[model samples]
Target: MLGGKSVLITGAGTGIGAAAARVFCREGAAVTLVARREKELAGLTAELTGAGHRAQYVLADVRQRADVARAVAAATEAFGGLDAAFNNAGLAAMPGPMHLVDDETYDSVMDTNVRGVWHCLQYEIAAMLEGGGGAIVNNSSTAGLVATVAGSPYIAAKHAVIGLTKAAANEYGSRGIRVNAIATGATRTGMLGEYLDQDPGREPAMAGKAMVGRLAAPHEIAEAAAWLCSDRSSYITGATVPVDGGRTAR
Candidate 1:
């Protein structure tokens, strides 16, 4: 677990990112939370600080490189250095065949899910190297490993995340940096609301197929992410640990 370290998380206002913020703070890491919504980021910062954990919020869009640079600099100013980060900002658009997906939709998803991660890792790793090295966990998904009911665009972006994690871990491991990913299954969060609304029956049907026979809680994914960010996972890098309810077991 974290102790006296500084951690940064993208899309940290709600759902899994917010849950991970709570976990990291509990583990003793001063957390810098970032999200597109200034309102939600401010609210989360107030809540964490009120609970006596060191937390700060930066308002920026993850898809923009300049904004990401500002966010990382803000973290260094606030905490002196960064020890870890979770590149968790992403989008899940509706399901559609590859040919049917529009250019705008494709670019938007890639901009946030793939390019956003690229910016975060580039800046965060630079900061970590200056501070002697650290750990990183990117939020991938079960969709990255296997085809889901989602569109081909999302799957492609997520698969790219896994590739990035492996590449970064291999390149930086010797330098004391550890990079990994979490592939999560049917965790109930805002990301699922649209699909659930389209067909309520589909959500539970997918949940039943999981080895655990239930939807994973967001905190469950957060816990796995926290472990990856901590010294406890010192031997774990260049790997994608599933936070799924054993959905990948079969």
Candidate 2:
């Protein structure tokens, strides 16, 4: 569905972001992967390129505006123009009592999850504008829609992501840019593994929250993002689609 598109994927080093790189390439997009870990980024880039996919990796921390700017430029220069982007770079703070959350933890979560998206939007939108138009998918969480067992900082950051998505979508829709978000549910990513490792018993509890009674596979979430970035979802904008296995439905 994304054939001939030039796509940018933040957090492309692992989890849903890495899955997105594969999915987007399979659907025929030239993908630019961005993340902080050079090892993961380079490995994924090599894997994709070896498979004959149009893919490249850029070492970047989405929290830095200059880094995001470079990532955008790389995409446009490599693939002709930016046609779509998946703003998936985010930080997940471990769950804890609200009052016990320290300032450092709060700042870190907010900066990575919220400010990261902010920086990405600013650059991605500009690149898309120059290319005449594009689609964008921000990776929010079920926490963004409703409170869960996540830490207070994570909840707040995800909420802000949805707000940014709506604001950007409303502002840019008429200009041919479409911005939307996915309210992701529990998934089997490294982040979740870390959370579960803290308390093995929590695994089933997390999975049980979903009506499907299982955590989502990374590719499942990536598939939703891919759809949103394609022309198939042309009429969709400023909307938060829940890919949460009915967790929010309850």
Candidate 3:
């Protein structure tokens, strides 16, 4: 799908982001993994390298514009130029009523989930523009399309991601840039596992929301993301693809 392409993936230490890195490499792309955890990034990099895939890792938090810029530059330096990017760094703030949420919780969630994507978009667009054009897939959520049980801040930030994706695609499609987003459902990620731990019933409850009657594996989401970054999805842009197992169908 992405043969010989240079790809950058953020939040790549684990979950959907990490899974996307492997998928992109398996499809013949050289991938650069970015995350806040150096240890995790190193371990994933070693694993990917051991598998005989061209892979590298950059330790950086997407919440910081400089860090995001550095990560993009590192990817370009490693692979010559960037052909694609998966902006997947995000966090779900504590779930509760809007009134119950405090300022700190709201700020933390918005800064990482909203501002983080904003930073990644800015640098990724710049890099892609230099190379002529590129593909980008932002990781939004089902909450982005509709109301969910997640915290108010998380829903708001995710909604903003879709907006940004559409705006970028509209602005750059004529220039050969395709920008899109995935509205993901509840997936089997470390964060989801922690959420399930807090309320064991929450797992089944979320799964029930999807028509598939089960939660998605991170790789499932990664596959769709990879396709979006590939030429196969060339005509697709300025849209939010739903990878929610029909959760939004209802």
Candidate 4:
């Protein structure tokens, strides 16, 4: 539980980010939501506040360092300081063979997925240090842990995320900042929906890849993140906790 804690969440307009916002609020944290979609952030903010949860929104594109800095400043200014963060902003890389992938696709995916976290880590770590300590959960994927048919660029970027997570944890763990990552399973988010649409009958096969025989719900992944960012997981850091429904069990 995160009672009275101040939390910041990237990509908070939808999917796991939005779900995390709700879960954190229900657990009593004042959450700051960040994303490029102003309308979605505004709407989610209103929904959280209306439900009697403390929440706010900042419009930002995580790929932009200035945008991320402003969002981080806004969160600290609003809540006094950040106690936790969920760096969940990401993009679904365009699926293609390595030989056929274009530079544009590579840049878009790497910039948003890799560089975006780099930008977030700088500001979030600084803020957490000032607050004496904090927890951070970066959203990696099952692809990060193993090879997948999803696009080489995506796999490479996610693998970079895990490396970043571990390195940060090793560097800051003693300083009271905990950094970890979650290797998520296929989930019913808009991105996955689009992927499934490409092959109308792909959903079941996708689910079958997991031992649980199902794709994860966004909230289920959110719960894992919340725990990672809470005292309940104080001993966890520099680790890639799998929320993949046993997808990587074998």
C-alpha RMSD of each candidate structure in angstroms: 0.9, 0.8, 0.8, 0.7
Highest lDDT scorer: 2
Off by over 4 Å in 3: none
Candidates in order have lDDT scores of 0.91, 0.95, 0.94, 0.94
- lDDT for 179 in candidate 4 is 97
Candidate 3 per-residue lDDT over residues 1-250, each given as its tens digit: 9999999999999899989988999999999999999888999899999999999999899988889999999999999999999999999865588988889999999999999999999999999999999999999999899989888999999999999999999999998999999999999999788888888899899999999999999999999999999999999998999999999998
On residues 1-250, what C-alpha lDDT tens digit does candidate 1 reach at each position? Answer: 7999999999899889999999999999999999988887898899999999999999989999999999999999999999999999889986478988899999998999999999999999999999999999999999889988778999999999999999999999999999999997888888886677678788788788799888888899999889999999899999998888888888
Q: Indicate whether candidate 1 or candidate 2 has the larger TM-score.
A: 2
Clashing pairs in 4: none
Model 4 CA deviation exceeding 4 Å by range:
none
> Which TM-score value belongs to model 1?
0.98
TM-score of each: 0.98, 0.98, 0.98, 0.99
lDDT-sorted candidate list, best first: 2, 3, 4, 1
lDDT of 4 by residue, 1-250 (tens): 9998999999999899999999999999999999999988999999999999999999899999999999999989999999999999999875577999999999999999999999999999999999999999999999999987578999999999999999999999999999999999999998788888889779999899999999999999999999999999999999999999999997
Put down candidate 2 lDDT per residue, 1-250, tens digits, no spaces. Answer: 9999999999999999999999999999999999999999999999999999999989999988899999999999999999999999988987489999999999999999999999999999999999899999999999999999889999999999999999999999999999999999999999888888888889899999999999999999999999999999999999999999999999
